[model samples]
Target: MNRDLLGRHRSVLPDWLALYYDEPLEITHGEGRYVWDSEGNRYLDFFGGILTTLTAHALPEVTKAVGEQAGRIVHSSTLYLNRPMVELAERIAQLSGIPDARVFFTTSGTEANDTALLLATTYRRSNTVLAMRNSYHGRSFSSVGITGNRGWSPTSLSPLQTLYVHGGVRSRGPYAQLGDAEFVAACVEDLEDLLGHTRPPAALIAEPVQGVGGFTSPPDGLYAAFREVLDAHGILWISDEVQTGWGRTGDHFWGWQAHGRNGPPDMLTFAKGIGNGMSVGGVVARAEIMNCLNANSLSTFGGTQITMAAGLANLTHLLEHDLQGNARRVGGMLIERLRSAAAQVPQVREVRGRGLMIGIELTEPGTDEADPRAVSAVLEAARDAGLLIGKGGGHNTSALRIAPPLSLTVAEAEEGAAILERALRSLP
Candidate 1:
């Protein structure tokens, strides 16, 4: 059954779309932290469908909300008043940390980022954008142009002239050996130097934790320091929280808070988990920036009643249950468990991340060289052992991504960690 489905998928889907494992399993259904494949095997879903499943699969509240909203109205477009959309927007705006925030919804993170680009360029009246050295915003033409990760970037042509910045990866850069304070200072100097040689950029966009770049993060307060420099030049700071938002990081509700000393970003883009499997993405910005799109704009399917309903239900459940606290407590334990396991394996170069967003970078036994093949082998072995994880990195996808749903339990964490340990041990 899996083979036949794979053949059909390959024939219909675009070739650029990648799949996991040598023999990919078809996930038919899921409940809580587990999913069942077409072959009647169950696996702990640690990657949470690329971190799109923020809460859990088949969450009763979100499921009921989606069903009821669909029964009433699937979509009415942005042409009409959307109460559910308005409510969701209000909630997000208040939580955004940006005063007088305005929310515009989209169907995916790509669109959310594209919207941000349009706002920044038009508002600042400049096309020059600053991006991190190994950052990925989205796949759209504008978003992809600012994305610095070569593995994910498909084309060089772009409407925006993007300048790459430093300080995204803390462990593998020229300034890697520096202490946190010195590292931040060095990166700031680099940014100043880059600015000296280029035109005034409209905005600097970055991810707090680079998801596709193997969950790498700069030292805390790095963005805050950059914010000081950007503010002096009146450049916008757009935080791409596509993979780091909705309290997955454990320590904060938003990943940008790690650098919040200089205040929230000018604009923030988000997606991947808020809708709890429904299609929901959006940007939150101060009124001055969000309203810069002069003429008129609307995403036809953005904030459809169905998706808004799901987002509202999911958000309510997340907050009411204090899942952020759950993420903090559970994620702390899980990371320590993985760290202990990774310490025993020489191929495991590093284990990093906050909250539930963890990454295990693989390298050759006695060397710093990344081992992408070893990453693939462990991923395959983990699947065979009834666990589902993910792979990502700028170094040829050499890191294992382990972002489970926010509702992960202690027992489930232990189970997944043991499976992962066995898989890692199998590597050379």
Candidate 2:
């Protein structure tokens, strides 16, 4: 039955839409941190649908909110006043940290980023932009141009002239050998040099932790240093918090906060987990930048009633439960356990990340080259052991990504880590 469904999916879906495993398992239902396949095999869900399920699977609060809102109204097309949308937007604005912040909703991170690009370019009146190396923003054409990872970028044709910058990946770069302060200085120097040779860019966009680039991050305060340079040149700074937002990083509610010594960024784009799998995304910017456009604009399905309700409920639960603190306590233990297990496996090049977003990078033993085959083997092994995880990296796609729901318990973390350890051990 699963094979038949896989055949149907392949036939109807785009080839670029990849699936996991040699034979894809059809997940039917889920609750808490666990999901059941069509064949009734239960598995612990660590990837959380690519980190979209922020709180939990089958979260009663979100489900109830969605159902109640749907029963009354599903969407109002952003034409009429949406109470839930307004409420959600207000809450996000308050939390965004951008002074006089205004929020505009979208349906996905890609669209949220697209809107951000529009705002940045319009506000600064420049087509050129700065992006980080080994970064993945979104799949939209505008966002793709800014993406530095070759594996995810499909084409060079772009609406904006994007210049890839340094500092996103700290472990495998020219500045990798330097100390933290020296690395920041080197990246800042490189940025200054790049700026001297190129057109004045509208903005410098980055992910605090590069998501698709395998959970890699630079030294703390790197962005704060970059912010100083950007401000001098009138270039806006945009923090892409799609994968790292809503306290997923544990120590910080937003990923940018780690590098926020100079205050918050000029604009912030978020998606992924906000709606807890309900497709909520948006851009938050100060009033001046957000209202730069003289003309009118509205997302047809962006701030629909149903998605807003879900986002509100999810955000409430996340805050009320102090899931961020839970993530910190639990994820710390999980990382330590995985690191101990990885020490026994030479193929495990590095185990890195913060909070619930972690990555185990694989390399051929004694070599720095990425071992994608090893990643594949561990993924298959983990699935066979009733664990569901995800994989990502730069051009090589060699890193195992583990971003469970923020509500992950200590026992679940330990269990997942054990399953992952066995999977790594099984890797040849």
Q: Model 2 clash tally?
A: 0
* Cα error of candidate 2 at position 358, Å: 0.3
- Range of the 10 consecutive residues with the lowest summed lDDT in candidate 1: 390-399
**Candidate 1: residue pairs that collide:** none
Provide the lDDT at 52 for model 2.
96
State model 1's lDDT.
0.94
Candidate 2 lDDT tens digits, 253-339: 999999999999999999989999998999999999999998988889998999999999999999999999988989899999999
Q: Write the per-residue lDDT of candidate 1 for residues 1-428, one digit (tens) a residue.
A: 48888999999999999888889888899999999998899999999989999999999999999999989999999999999999999999999999999999999999999999999999999999999988998899998899999999999999999999999999987999999999999999999999999879999999999999999999999999999999988899999999999999999999999999989999999998999898999999999999988797888999999999999999999999998999999999999999999998999989999999999999888887889999999999999999999998887777999999999999999999999999998886
